[model samples]
Each structure stands twice: as C-alpha cells, then as structure tokens.
Target: MKRYAIIVAGGKGERMSSNLPKQFIQLRGIPLLMHTIKVFYDYDSLIQLIIVLPANQISLWKKLCNEHNFTIPHEIVQGGETRFASVKNGLVAIKEKCIIAVHDGVRPLVNRQTLENCFSTAEHYGTAVPVYAIVDSLRKTENNTNFAVERNQYCIVQTPQVFQSSILKIAYNQTYEERFTDDATVVESLGIELNLVEGNRDNIKVTTPPDLKIAEVLLSEREAIIS
Candidate 1:
C-alpha cells in the first residue's frame, strides 16, 4: 500500500521565544521541519509527504526551502485554527486509500525503526500509535486533594500515529470537538481500538528553548554513532 505522512507544523514559536515558528528554528544547521521531512523521505522515497503550515507562514516556509536549497518534493497545505482542524484539512488533501502517518513536524528525532514499526503495525491493525512507558511518579489532583496513582497505568503518547487512510478519513468526518487532542483520540472516538507500539525516547516534540538544546545534543549523539 502507498504510504503518506501529514506533518503538522503550525506552531508560532511563542514558547521558544523566537520570532520564527518552532519548526522553522534551526536544529543544528537545518530547520527542524526539514530534518523531520528528510528523515521520512530517507525512510521511503515513495512516501508522499504533505506539510501543513499556518496560511500566513506558507510563503515564509517556501522562502526558507529556497534558501536552504531543500528541493525534496512535497505538498504544502494551509492549517486551520486548531490542531483538529489542521489534521482535518490534511485529510481532505488525501484522495486515495493508503496508510497515513500523522506526525508532529517538531518531532525531528523519530527514528527509522519507530517509523517502520508504526507503518507496518498500522497496515495490519488499521491503526497504530507510538507510546512510551511513564517512568515517573504520577498523581491525581481533585479539588485541593492529591492522590497517588500507578505510573505504569499511564503512557506518554508520541506521534507518527499511523492509520489506514480510509479509517482516518472516516474518523475526521465527525464534527470537531475540543477533546480531540490527537489523531488517536479522534480515531478512538469511533470505537476503534488503537494498537500501541514502542517509541524511542529521543522522539521528542521540540517546543521550548530547553527542548532545542536537548535536540541538539541528541543529534550530536546520533552523528557520533554514525561516525
């Protein structure tokens, strides 16, 4: 089946304290979003890439691509007011039934193995969501009281949330709701159970300045391994 990735990168960078969107910020010597796109391209040259950006930022993104000489062919779609809307916009651009991976463009460190696993699992199960086990203590706050909970009961959800295109398309047809935080949530609302897969710890969504530093370190470590 054909593979497609809808990379949602509509951040305005207010958290990163930068004028540019977080995805446009330089990770090492390249834009973070470029690193994400290149990795998926490297994974499978046949995989169709669709980038979703804020309507006003599309021109800036194009200019950045020209300046960087980044010529990997991909379609750019305008994002919507909310992430749910943004994803729905992306789903509209897909006309064929295939495997689709909805990913955060800021997550530049999604390893090849994780990508392969998600797609392969989704192909079989109709939906796959990458998650990492929570290793820290957890708590539940109610009113002014706090109670301890089992950390193992919760998992950290990561993206490249892959699903059959038809399932995702059908899921997006529901009226937008505030609780639809992620693609998995949207699909789950349809009574579809999600298949979970292991996610690499390095697969982080870069949002703040500290996240940028962590990504730089992670990239350097990976390069060291390659060298």
Candidate 2:
C-alpha cells in the first residue's frame, strides 16, 4: 500500500524559552525538522512526506532548507490554530487510498523499527499507535489535592500514529473538540479501538532546552553506534 506521513510542528518555543520555534532550533548543526523529514525519508523513500508548519513560519522553513542544502522532497502545508486543525490541513493534501501516519516533527529519535511496526500493524488493523510503559510513579491531582495512583495501569503514548486513510479522514472530518487530545483520541471518540505497539523510549518530543540537550546526546550516541 502507498504510505503518507504528516509531520505536525506548530511549537512557538514558549516552553523552550526561545524566540525561534522549537522545530527550527539547531540540532547537530541542522534544523531539527530536517532530521525528522530524513527519518521518514529513510524509512521509505517513496512515502509521501507532508510537513505542516505555522503559516507564518513556512517561509523561514524554506529558507532554512535552502541554507542547509537539504534536498529531500516533501510538500509543505500551512498549519492551523490547533494541532487537530494542523493535522486536518495536512490531510487535505492526500486524496488517495493509503496508510497515513501522523507524527510529531520534534520526535526525530523514533527508530525505523517502530515506524515499520506501526505502519505494518496499521496496514492490517486499520489503526496503530506506539506506546511506552511508564517508569515513574503515578499521581492524580484534583481540586488542589494530590495522591499516588497505580503506575502500572498506564503508558506514555508516542506518535507516528498510523491509520488507514479512510478512518483517519473520517475521524478528522468531525468538528474539533477540547477532549480530542491526540489523533488516537479523535478516532476513539467514534468507538474505533486503536492498536498499540511498543515504542522506543528515546523517541522523546523535543520541547525544552534540556530536552534538546538530551536529543543531542541521543543523536550522538546513535551516530556512534552506526559508525
């Protein structure tokens, strides 16, 4: 089946304490988004890559691509006010039947194996998302109160959430809602169960400065291993 990957990056870098958007921050001398695009390109050169960025940031991204001499082919879509809307915009570029994987542009560490597992599972199950078991103790807080909860009952959900285009398009067609935290939630609202596959813990979404440092270390280690 044909494959499509929609990479959503609308971060304003508020949490990262930077004026530049987090996705455009430098990682190992290249803009972070380029690394993300390369990962999907490596996974399947024929896979259609769509990057959804804020409308105002599109020109900056193109300039960065030219400055870095980044040549991997991808289509750019202007993002919306919300992640849901951004993803929906990215979906607009797809008009054919194929598998679709919605991913976070900041999560460049997602291994190829995880991508393969997600796309392969979604190819058969109609939906698939990667998840990693939580290692920290759990807590629940409400009304200015907090208490420990069972940690074993939950896991951290990661992206590259793959789904059949038919279901994804249908899920995105509904009006946006505050309760729709992620693509999986959007699909689940329609009573569609999502298949979860094991995800690599290193596939962390870069948000803060410390997160960027961690990504640099992880990327260096990966290069060391590869070389």
Candidate 3:
C-alpha cells in the first residue's frame, strides 16, 4: 500500500509576529517545517510526501530545501488561502487507491510511534484520527459570556490524520462550508466512520512566540541527551 504525507505549510505567521510564514520560522537553527518533514521521513522512508506552500512563497521553500541539503524527493503543491483549501490541493496531487496522511507542518514533535499507529490503523479502517481525551474542565465563552460543558464529551484533535487515499480525495472534492476544522470533519460530512487512537501530548502545533521557545527547549534537551 502506498502511503502519502501532505505537509500543509501555508499559514502566514500573523500570531508569530513575523513577516514570514510560521512554518518557515527557525527552531534550533533549522526551519520548523523541515523538522516536521523529518519526522515522517524518519518514521518511514517509503511514505511519499506532498508539501503545500503559499503560492508566492514556493520559491523560498525550494531554496531552503536545496540549501539545507534535503534529500527527500517530495512534490510541492501551491497552497490555498485556508487550511482546508491547502489540504484539498494536496489531495488532488495524489493518485487513487492508497493511504494518505494530512499533517500540519508546524507540528514538529509528532512521534514516530504515532505515525506508525495512524498508518497501521488506517489500513483497515477507511479513516483514522489521532485524538487525546480532554482532561481539564471545559467551558465555552463567547463575547465574554461563559457556558459550562461536560469535559468528558470532548477530545483534543491532533494531526497526521490518515485515511484511504480514494475516500479522502472524494471527501475533499465535496463542497462544504468554511467550518471544516480538520480532515476528520470533512470525512464526517460524507457520513464515514472514523477510528480514533491515542495521541501524544508532546505532539504540539506551533503557532506563537511562546511555542517557539518551548520547541527550542525540547530540542536543546534532546540534543544534550544525545551528545
């Protein structure tokens, strides 16, 4: 079975307080997006990769890939304005009848075990998602109004969301509202059954300056132990 990884890296770093996209930000001297890709590569070399970047920033991505001596032969697709559109673009690049995993490029800490689990589970089930059960009390706030909710009912969604390539492509092809938060939501729209597995808490999606600091600390500790 052919496995594909779509790394969506097109978000502008508005919250990151940088002119460049958040995925392009440096973490421990290397681009954060590169670290995300390396996780997939390390997990399984046989997995094919499709990276989505902002249309105007494709040139910059190519240059970085070349300069960093990136050896993976992955395809690059032009990203859309929203995350859903960017993933849809990637779905189009893949051929039919395979396994495909969509991942946020800013999440560099997805462990190899998680990738393996997602892919393994997805092989049998049409859709598989990594999710963590919420452990904290939850409340909904809108315009400073707070509403209480049952924490037991919620789970925090994480990525490397895996599905059968054919099914996923068909799901993405269906038009929907901008409310599609993730690939699982798209699959849910098609009335498909989704399988869930445990996700590591360490698998974080970087979006702000504080996230960068946390990632730096993680990388430093890892390297110190390795050396």
Stretches > 4 Å off in candidate 3: 141-147, 223-227
The TM-score of candidate 1 is 0.98
Task: List the lowest-lDDT window of 10 residues for candidate 3.
Answer: 217-226
What lDDT tens digits, residue by residue, belong to model 2 across residues 173-202? 999999998999999999999999988999
Candidate 1 runs further than 4 Å off = none
In candidate 2, position 126 carries an lDDT of 99
What lDDT tens digits, residue by residue, belong to model 1 across residues 1-227? 99999999999999999998999999989899999999899899999999999999999999999999999989999999999999999988899989999999999999999999999999998999999998889999999999999998899999999999989999999999889999999999999999999989899999999999999999999889979
User: Pairs clashing in candidate 3?
Assistant: none
What TM-scores do the predictions have? 0.98, 0.98, 0.93
The local distance difference test score of model 2 is 0.96
- Error (Å) of candidate 2 at residue 159 is 0.6
In model 2, the runs with Cα more than 4 Å from the true position are none
Q: Give the per-residue lDDT digits (tens) of candidate 3, residues 76-177.
A: 999987888899989888876799999999999888778888999999877789988888889999997999899988888999999998789888888867
Best by TM-score: 1
Model 1 residue 173 CA deviation in Å: 0.4
